[model samples]
Target chain A: MKLIYRHLGAIKIVALLAFMVFVCLPLVQMTLLAFVATLPHEELEVGQATLQNFSGILTDPNLRAAFGNSIAYVLINICITIPVALPAAYAFSRMSFVGDKSLFLAFIAFRITPPVVLTLPVFQLFSALGIVNSVFGIALAHCLFNLPISIWILQGFISAIPREMDETAFIDGYSRPRFIWSILIPQIRAGIAVAAFFCFMFSWVEVVFARILTTTNGKPISMAINALFGFQTDIGLVMAVTLASMAPGAVLLFAMRNHLSRGFRIGQV
Target chain B: MKTKDNSGWIFVLPAMAVLGLIGLIPLVTVVNYSFFEIFILSSRFWVGLEWYGELVGSARFWQSFARSSLFSMIILLIQIPLGIALALCIPRGRIWIGLSLVVVALPLLVPWNMIPTLWLSLLNPETGLLGRLGVVLGWPLDWKDSAVHTWVVIVMMDVWHWTSLVVILCYSALTTIPAAYYQAAAIDGATPWDVFRFIQLPRLQNVLLMAVLLRFMDSFMIYTEAFPINAGGPAEATLFLAVDLGEEIKAFNYGPSAARSVLYFLIIVTVAWLFTKAQGKLEEKAAP
Candidate 1:
């Protein structure tokens, strides 16, 4: 047993090293690309690093607006998804209605439905509504996907809370809205964080709907990166945009690190 | 027991309404379009089931399905075990565990399309580290033109991108296992394999199933990372289902695309249903 433990220690170190190298090497390279002025083979001295790539992205109105658009939609998506999911999640956790199971299953079904599959119809529908090329259109489309998962995750958290709290609040003359706002939400802060994290990650990274809906206007950072490859390729500039896109996620992950693993556990059950 | 009341409708109605406005409309429109040969929504001819019939016979459609299945299968085979092993290897010591988790999770935070961009730069033959290493080993990377290479690169990219989710799931599940379980196993002088079988595996089973559910669904429809790298190319080698659907939509093949999408949605829902059923079975089997 002692020998096995020793071997396991060595294995853990080796695995950790291998894992870091595998995961970080590419990111490190990409970061380096972002900082450098020119690719090595592209008529520039090796190690001639500069901050031009970052500045280049900010100065370009199109890329800057795209960065803004991506943030706007992601924020809009979380705003819509969480509020809509919360009440339904509360209902799911506390109350049972007719066809509740089937309706929930339908949500799971819709949640798994491929975004690509809905491209044509969603495009037609959105265009008819005159929301094509609009950030709000992207945000609304994202809600269709994000709301289900948001509900699923939030329901699990809400379920874990004892129903006795609700009774106590009511008995104490707490209004329903007051109870939810002051009691229910604070208790499920972690779950809300997790749900919002997912909604943010998915909506921020979502390319298909963002691509289809924002063809002529309101390109997100992803489209801006796409356009950066036209004619002459600026490798450094593209990597800068990619790195910028990851910032919100990185920030959120740091803030939610403690809640996330615990949140996933609740989600599984 | 939970409350059973009709008033639940009041709480759920908002979500249902929102979904109906956004979700049901497109869905109904898809079904509507599937029944017609649509051109620009204005020019249309009723062609009930024709597009579905065409899809049934289309070799390209079947090929994309096969590619997607294969890609998904490869992803599952790699990510699940790798994630589990990594999770187990995470030191139980508090500091080490936190550091391992955060480092492992870093890749997952990278946006989807950027994954390929990151990989492409890192695999650049002249400027990249791994590319240069490959040259030193006489196995220079060639994802640009070789179908086999493209498949390998994209599979590797997906694994790198998503394995963290599995790791996080498994790690969290591991943490839920009480410390006394290990102490008892040690008292019994249990081998590592025995301990894993009797304790860890049971706990891992659910999360692993979930990892499969998420990974399979996502990989089966992979497009964002893949399209940028090779655009489902080197002669359609990497053309997974979503990428194929993307091509059709880009071409404005509305009727066919709608029919194709309906079928695609059905496949995902069926797979998800199957997994959920299996999860139920597992729960039942475990229950006394």
Candidate 2:
């Protein structure tokens, strides 16, 4: 029985490793494709890898603008979302006001509404405001979805903190703002990190709004990548840009892996 | 436990304002536009529910709706079970735990637009590793001509992209389970299945419900990945609801598109409501 159990354990490990390889295969292919100076039609040869694709893509004006725009708008979206969500989430966790339940439900409803449904209306709305193809516009547009989710996740995180913490802080003569800044914030730093990571991820990866809301001026990396899909672009250059797009998210995930794992348990993300 | 503090309104006001300006206004505008015959954004004639009527009577709308529902169902069926199994199989050591978590999250971090492109390159028969392997295995991996192959690829891509979400959630829930329960089960000579069935599954109910809700919503809204893959090709076999809506918008058919949008929103809201109700009932039943 012991021997059989040990063998089963070995089998499980082998299966997991196989699964990991399967999951990573496409990514590995894309990375390799980015490096090699081979077209989709040409056969890949060993040791033919070159850095030209990377240099070629990085030097392209449109691709460079897209990279900058993507980073800018994602950061802007995170900035707009977190501060607003923090107070609202605090309220939901600690206090009850009129229509609070209904308001909360409405937020969830907004989160559920498909971005495609809002695409046309948002395009029209932004056009009227003369903010179409602007980074601020896309950032605001993203808040339509990101804010609710951030609030929801932060509310979960805040509620998990003991009520006594708040009570004790008040008794110790810490002003509300000071208490939030110094005491409450530090306690839920992991939650904030997770929430910020999610906001950044969603805004960075979202393509629908980015596609419709911006045309040329603030075209995001996703839109640029999609444009390449339309024309007969070189596969190597496309792969390089795609790989570059994954870098920010990869860095964020690695940096906050611990907070993310913890946040999953507490924030229900 | 409720605190009677209307002062909370002050806290919620900024978010509410932003949400109202950005979210609710557009939503209301979409509903309003559904009732008009819109030639353009600024030019419209009052049509009074004609678009909605047309949408309801349209065969394409029904087809896309059914397609979307089927896709979401398949995603849930595969990802949930596979996620649970993988979560169970994850090695319980410090380095293994950290490595697995990061590896699982890698796919989720890739931008939505790049996902289809990545898969396309990987499945390209001439150059892709999978394609070459398929050739060796004598399997027809053509996505262009075979609807079945297209569907298989879409499902495979989705499972690969999203199973990590389920794994993470379930793994976290598993971690919260006390070791005492497992020890008791072992002492009682319980089978591995018995230990899982009694202890882990019960503890997993809440997180699993959450996982189901999220996976359903995300999959239902899937467009960025599916569209770039085949653009609802192979005779429109993969033309899900969002892709269908996108076509209308692309053609600048604002009226019918708005109606479709409203209907799509309603379907999502209703299904989500039903899920929440079901979850509440389950919790009530589970509680002593």
Candidate 3:
């Protein structure tokens, strides 16, 4: 019986090790392939590693511009999302409004709507305004997708926070705005951070609408990465762009590693 | 819960305004466009039900709808249970939790474009590890040329990317299960399975429903990763509704695309509504 139990423990360990290795395989390959002199065009290889691909992409002006645009767009999205969502979340969490439940669900319903559904109308709308390919145009479009998610997650977080906090602040002579800014904001700092990270990440990585809306100057990194998907593949450039695109999200997650994971766990549930 | 301040309205205005201007306006536009015959974005003629009739009658549109719905169903059927199991395995406490989380989250942080690219290379039949191994072992795996293979690749990629979402959600719900619940169960001589079945599972219902709905909606609208992988190829085997809609929009077939989009939205909204209703029903059943 003891021998059987020991064998079972060994099996579990082996399974865990195998699953870990399997999950990490793509990351390992991507890192190794990025610096490789020549990636296997049709298929990946255990190749000779070098820094040429990364250098090539970084040095290109257009690529740099797109990278910059991605950062700017994400920053704009965060700014727009935080102010808009924080209040809406406060309303949903604190007050009972007419049509509150259904309205909240409606917002989520819109969030769940596929971007493709609105693509042409948005194109026409932007084109009519002569901002079809502009940064602000793309940023507005991003808010359409990201704001509801931000509000939903923030509402969840705010609901989890006790209502007594709000009443306590009110009783202590805090004005509404002051109370929200000074009292409520501090309490939900973690939620705000989580919302901000998600808004940034979604805006940073979105491709479909980004592709349709932005032509040149406002082209984000996902669009830039799309440029790498060619029939005649330049694996080197593709690897370079892929790595460059993922780097920010990767770095941010690494920096706020614990918090980010906690956010995902909380935000999702 | 005061209705008088209207200050709460001020808070909601920006988000509502943005959503209204961009999200809501376009939707209204799409509905309006679906009733017209549009050409070159310049001229349009009112043609009520014409585009809808054309879309509904088109075998291609129906085929793609079927394909997308099936794929989403399959993903949910597989991912939810698998995610719950993975979440169950993860122990509570800060020790080693950080490292484990990093492991789970690494794949999720990879760019959307990168996911398909990673899978494409990983499953490469020549020098790609899965491909090379399959050839050597005789699995005949070729995603680029086979619909079955493409679906498998897409499913695998999705599972890899999103099971983390479910796992993390379930984990959060699991951890919040107070020690007293388990202790009380154990004191009553409940088995591990009994504890999970009676206490843990019920607590997880809301989150699980959310996970399922989120996955359903996301997978139904899947495009970015799937598009780059095969471009909906292999004789349109992997061609889902989004891909079909994308092609239509790309070709500037605005009327038909709008009609199709409406149908797609209706289907998704219906499913989501059904889910919420079901959740409400479950809660009512649990009420004393």
Query: After aligning candidate 3 to the native by TM-score, how far in Å is the CA of B247 from where it should be?
Result: 0.8
Give stretches of model 3 more than 4 Å off: A1-19, A39-47, A261-269, B1-7, B141-145
How many clashing residue pairs appear in each of the predictions shown?
A: 0, 0, 1
> Residue A207 deviation, candidate 1, in Å?
0.8
Query: What DockQ, between 0 and 1, does each candidate earn?
Result: 0.60, 0.61, 0.49
The full ranking of all candidates by lDDT, starting with the best, is 2, 1, 3
The DockQ score of candidate 2 comes to: 0.61
Give the Å shift of residue A30 in candidate 1. 0.3
Off by over 4 Å in 2: A1-8, A39-47, A97-99, A267-269, B1-4, B141-143, B178-190
Candidate lDDT scores, in order, read: 0.83, 0.84, 0.77
Q: Name the lDDT of candidate 3.
A: 0.77
The digit string of per-residue lDDT tens for model 3 on A1-269 reads: 54644475455446445656767777766776677766453344536666767887878887888888888878887888889888898887777666667777778777788887888888888888887777777887888768888887788777777777778888998877798898788887888887888787777777767888897668887777777666766676776787777778777766655565445333322
TM-score, every prediction: 0.93, 0.93, 0.91
After best superposition, candidate 3 residue B45: deviation in angstroms?
A: 1.1
Q: Tens digits of per-residue lDDT for model 2 on A1-269?
A: 65756586787788778779979999999998889876543464533787777887768888999999998998898899999999898888888888888888778778877889999888888999999999989999999878987887788688878899888999999976688789888888888888888898778888889988888689998888777764566777788888888888888888876666555554332
**Candidate 3's error at B110, in angstroms?**
2.4
lDDT of 3 by residue, B229-272 (tens): 88888888888878878888889887888888888889999999
